[model samples]
Target: MANQTKADRAKIFMPFDAVKGFREALAEKERIIVPKTELSEERKEELDRRLRMIHTGDIITVVYFHDGEYVKLTGMV
Candidate 1:
């Protein structure tokens, strides 16, 4: 221990997942599979109108579905 370098000491405390792949498997099991819903004609028209109103520099928040989940992201258009 007395002769160990700074880099060697840092390596001793490095983080690691004790249970490999266990967290991911648990998360996958907890996730509910949701079916995608079809949008009605009126709903589709409303979404189209809102999309057309967005400009290049506008800041917008959008909810989109990916991998069986709806994620909301806010950023500049």
Candidate 2:
């Protein structure tokens, strides 16, 4: 009705978060995390040698485990 104020009309359109905190819980569930890897002395040496060979401007791809799955990122070093 023309007599209704904006605040009164707005109540009809108000929304509620019925499933509050569920999305946050789902986000926590899907968030990627992995345990730190332990490298053997020989393996560490090999990786150190490879890292020392790269220049600052070189491009490289890093592959590692996240939540037990391998994730890759490509970028310039």
Candidate 3:
């Protein structure tokens, strides 16, 4: 029998009013995840299409904030 292992996770932080800068940072690392807005049906469809490509065991890094204060970053594999 084979043994199963859990994935890894991480968290980081960046400035809030630095959206463009954030993208530049990701680009430099050769990795990124741009969020898709769900403002309309068309946008939702686009997001769905993009998300469909994501799969398990794939690494995902999420950027956000805690208590709407400091910027919070996290990653899952």
Would you estimate the TM-scores of all the predictions? 0.70, 0.48, 0.31
* Of candidates 3 and 2, the better by TM-score: 2
lDDT of 2 by residue, 1-77 (tens): 99999999998898765798987899888876767688899999998999889999999988877766568899998
Q: Give me the overall lDDT of model 3.
A: 0.55
Record all residue pairs in model 2 with backbone atoms less than 3 Å apart, i.e. clashing: none
Model 2 weakest lDDT span, ten residues long: 62-71
Question: How much lDDT does candidate 1 score?
Answer: 0.91
Descending-lDDT candidate ranking? 1, 2, 3
lDDT tens readout by residue for model 1, 18-51: 8999889998998887877789999999999999
The all-Cα superposition gives candidate 3 an RMSD in Å to the true structure of 15.7
In angstroms, the error of model 3 at 13 is: 24
lDDT (Cα, tens digit) per residue for candidate 3, span 41-68: 8866976786787787877654443433
Off by over 4 Å in 3: 1-38, 62-73
Scored by CA lDDT, what does every candidate get? Answer: 0.91, 0.85, 0.55
Residue 40 of model 3, lDDT score: 88
State how far residue 32 of model 3 sits from its true place (Å): 25
